[model samples]
Target: MKGTGEEVVSLFYIGTAIMLFLAFGLLFIVVTYQRHFFRMKRKEAENMLKVSLESEKNERARIAADLHDGVSGDLSAIKNYLSVLAKKESENKEIFDEIREGVDAALQNTRAVSHNLMPPLLETEGLVPALKGYLESIGAKAQIYFEVTANGAVALPASVAYQLFRVLQELTTNMVKYGNVSKCDINIALNKEALTIDITDDGTPFNFRENLAKPNASGLKNINSRLHAVGGVIVQEEEKQVGNHFTITLKNVNNA
Candidate 1:
């Protein structure tokens, strides 16, 4: 009976040991699984961010194409028809002129919107003229004075011009949307090796870091992406009693 009792105690100790071993094994597996799950989740989040950014660019291109190819063509036809009708109604010239003016305004607005979406001049005429046209168009509407001073001709490659144009457009948009909507100065200078653009606005100070983190601040993202494409760097300077000052630099300019 004593020996039987001792055997029962030994069996109980073995059972307890087995339970502990199983528990530790289960914990190890669970921890490994959790680590893998978290890693996959992080990767998925990064991929989603990339997809969203690319989607925005694709959507912009699609909308620009639709406006340029569809809406602009219709407006051009309407303007032509209005011109013919006005000539036919020479007796009531004043009424026709009024109607013609309305049509002309509509056509002009359509073209402006199209140009703003995708500026053909940027591709054809080059960057400086494109910037001038864009600034002039927006300035007329916003009634804000913009001064662009180019010390030397900015003859950039086509690809570089496109990216730089986008960066400037984004900056101008941000300035108009958040700045004081007053006069802004743009200085473009080309050195022997690099190109630089300095834009200073006379508006409220901007929080660059905070704004860039906001979800709705896609324009800031776009600016970063464009700069990245051109291998450029951006520097923001704070000015007392002045608005946001942005400096963009492109080094080792390579032709596309």
Candidate 2:
């Protein structure tokens, strides 16, 4: 009877162990499946974001081309005609000169708008030169100084460069408009494993994360989206006694 009891106890223990193992195996499979499903969804969302940004860029480029090639050309022709009229008709010289001045101003504005939409330097010279040219172009008008420096250099994909430039542009615009900025510094560093950009400003400090949560933070949201599409991240450093600092990082990118 005792032997029978021992055998029953052994059988019961073995059954429990097998049940526990089967339960754990089933749980692991379920968890793995859930993880994979979430990963796929995240990937799909990123792909959609990239597609949307690319479409926006293409549209901007088209509009810029139209403004430069079509509108600018027509305005130039008109200006030239006005110049000839001003010289030929001495009686209406003042009026022609006034009209010519207006046309010249319009031409300048059109070119500025088209350039802002899609900078030719960006397409031709690359990111650094584009940024420098942008800063120089805006320096006199914005009443703010900008300095750009690089520790290491690598040729970035055009898409990445465009998005990064847009991000910086948005931030600089915000600083100029709201931060009462005086001087801004932009530093770029690249290594085999990562690329980092540090932007600092001597301006009124603002809370980036807090502002990002506000309803009227579209510019900040756009910056976030652009970085996400490029697998980069922007982090605002903790505020000190003065100034604002932001860091952008991209990891595991192929420098080659």
Please give the lDDT score at residue 7 for candidate 2.
94
True-structure RMSD, every candidate: 7.7, 2.4
Give the per-residue lDDT digits (tens) of candidate 1, residues 1-256.
9999999999999999999999998999999999999999977765665456456556666777787778877877877887888788889878877876887787777777767766878778888888998998787777789888887677888767877887898888777777766898899888876888998888888777688899998988878866765678888876556677889998987632
Tens-digit lDDT string for candidate 2 (160-213): 888988998999889888988889999988886788999999899899999999
Q: Residue 196 lDDT in model 2?
A: 94
Among the numbered candidates, top TM-score falls to 2
* Estimated TM-score for each candidate: 0.67, 0.88
Q: How close is candidate 2 to the true structure, as a TM-score?
A: 0.88
lDDT of each: 0.79, 0.90
- Model 1 TM-score on a 0 to 1 scale: 0.67
